[model samples]
Target: MNPALQGLLTIIIGVGGCVGYFYFSNQFLDKVLFPASGPNAGKNINRANIIRPWLFLLPALLALGVYLAYPVVETLRLSLTERLPDGGSAFVGLDNYEQMLDEPKFWEALKNNMLWLLIVPALSTAFGLLAAQLSDRVFWGNLAKSLIFMPMAISFVGAAVIWKLVYDARPIDQDQIGVLNALYIFFGGDSPNNWLTIPFWNNILLMIVLVWIQTGFAMVILSAALRGIPEETVEAAIIDGASPFQVFFKIKVPQIMGTIVVVWTTITITVLKVFDIVFAMTNGQWETQVLANYMYDKLFRSHDWGVGSASAMIIMLLVMPILIWNVYNARKEMQ
Candidate 1:
């Protein structure tokens, strides 16, 4: 069979199968669960009709269980077992957890992760808001928005590769190589510094990459929010002798505070799970490891499934509170 024809036939069959299944299921359910609900009890209670949409939700729930719930349970179980030499395992309860607490490298990774959480969201949101506010007062606002949002179009791995070249270090005696170090040397600095090898500064540099990528997302969201601010509010504030700063902080900010929190919390979760940039740039070397990097190292490099799982679980534990808060904030906004 022609490959294109085969693929088209497969898709047609799959879609037809789904349609048939749903139709049969709905008919069976209506006959079994909603057979007039004791005709004497109801002339026509609309209750059964209201539940038709829910009949279609079972497949989604099953998919969620297989993809999300099972792995989580398995990871938690793996965290308690030590990977034995012969591909078997030894159950060592809480040893991995205890070791993780005492390990200096773990602490360093945590510190870097914390720094990421602290810096990226604030800087991204600030830069985003600044760009958003500035874009509104311009003739080329769409152009400006496109430029600011361009970074988001790049994949994380691609962005990391681009920055790797930008931060690349070469011999000082040779022509300056990396863009940043080139500028540094042009300013009379002695040597091309290995920006990825420095301790705290490398973390900051990594944070800059995330901020660069996420600022575009922030800008797109916040630009909309800023535009949504009622002009009357700004005019009213100005009529009351309020300055631009006052109108921004007191009037515009108050209305958009929920969106800001949502953006912050959303990025905070990403920061917690960040592995690619650190992994690509430094491979969790030079104390620049975050939780995600640490998890990768434990699982793949050291082959310690237990510790890796514990590390992953710890990351999950840390992220849950923020996730709950984000949900609460979202609900409040909806209300």
Candidate 2:
């Protein structure tokens, strides 16, 4: 068979199989097993209802287990083992982690990532809240929101590329094409500075990209939460002589604290897994290393799976709290 035809057939069969499974499972439960019109009709129907959701969820659960759960387990195993010369693996326990800890670059990456975790979410949320409030009061609010929200739709790599020009450096002799340097020179600065080559500050510059992208996401979500605020509450705040700032920070914010936490954690997770921007901009140079970029370097660049997995596990550990919170929130909301 042609490869394309084979792939099409495979997809058809897989989808057909899932549909058939659900359809027949229901048929068996209702007709053969339950027979809901019988003397025990009520009990049979109750049993079928209890089983039905799990049956429908079976495929998704299976896929999640095999793809997500299994890879996680396998990566953990790899983190604890060293690949040997003859294609075998030997358990090295915490040796890989020790190796990573001993390295200066790993330490740098860790510190930088911690800084990113602290700054990105806070800044993104702040900017988002500002945009949300401002847009709400503007005549062309939707247009303003759309333009600000545009960055969220951009891929990280694309955003990185876009900002590359913004941070670009040129020799002192040539005209600076970068927006930052041009403004600096136009203001009578000595020379164009290479933004990404500056330590500590470079990390901040790189962070600007993530913030630019995530702020829009935060804006849209917080905007919705802001809109959902009861008009009566705002009226009451005004009646009490509360200032606009006080009304927003005290009345409006407290009401949407849960949504704010949701947005913060969501961005926090994104920051933990950040790589493409760093990769595209500085590639972890100039002390701008982040965990994800560090992990990629170890895994693929250095071909050291053990240390790589250990770094990945570190990221996973950092993400766990937010992940747990999200899961808890989702379950609570469901209830």
Candidate 3:
């Protein structure tokens, strides 16, 4: 079968099925369940109207249940069960969690994730705010914003590949191709250093990649938030003898603090789920393990599904609070 033809047929069938289902369901609801030709027609019509929205929402709800809710429940179940030699499993509650907790690598991954949580969101948000402010002041602000926000378009792995080259190293005798080592040699440093192998510093270096990508996202959001600030407030502050810095910090920043928190939590969620850059650049070597990559290593490399699922649950637990907070803030803003 032709691939394009198959795709077209799939699309046609999907659309046809949806249209047919909705048409028939509404017919059943109107003619059979709530016939308009009866004594209770008005009540039936009212009830049908009430249920109509749910009919529209049913497909999406079912999708979320199947795709989103199912995996979480299955992962939790897997986390609680141990695999047996006969391809069966035994329930071993908390044993996987205990083993994961006891592993030094798991602790290292957790520590690194904490470090990422602390550093990446803060730096990304700060840099984004700074860029937003500075770009607005410049004559070529849009162009500047475009350049700064460009990294957001790149995939994490692609950005890792790019920065990987920037941090690449070679022997002293050969010409340095990496931007960092070239500058190092230009400044008369003796040997080229492998920037991704320096343990704690390597973690910082990997974080810079994420920060670079996320800063663009932060900038775009914070920029809109900054623009949404009332000009009257700025003018009033300036007229009241507030210095530019004071006006920005005291007036503008306070107005956008909600946005700032949203951006911070948004990036924090991304940080907790971070895996690609670490996997691509260092593969969690040099004591730079993160929970997602550590889970991947366990689930795939070591074939340890129970422990892997346990780690996954841990990541979900860590992310849930911030997720809830973010949702709360969003609802408050809507109200």
Highest lDDT: which candidate? 3
Q: What is the C-alpha RMSD of each candidate to the true structure, in Å?
A: 3.4, 2.7, 1.8
* Worst lDDT 10-window in candidate 2: 321-330
Highest TM-score model number = 3
TM-scores for every candidate against the unseen true structure: 0.86, 0.89, 0.94
| Worst ten in a row by lDDT for model 3 | 321-330
The sequence of per-residue lDDT tens digits that candidate 2 reaches over residues 130-155 is 99999999799999999989998899
Tens-place lDDT digits, model 1, residues 97-190? 9988899989988888888888999999999988998889899988988988998888888989999889989886787568999999889888
Clashes of each: 0, 0, 0
lDDT of each: 0.86, 0.93, 0.95
The true-versus-predicted C-alpha distance at residue 225 of model 2, in Å, is: 1.3
Ranking by lDDT: 3, 2, 1
Over 4 Å off, model 3? 1-5, 327-335
- Candidate 1 Cα outliers beyond 4 Å, as residue runs: 1-17, 27-54, 83-91, 329-335
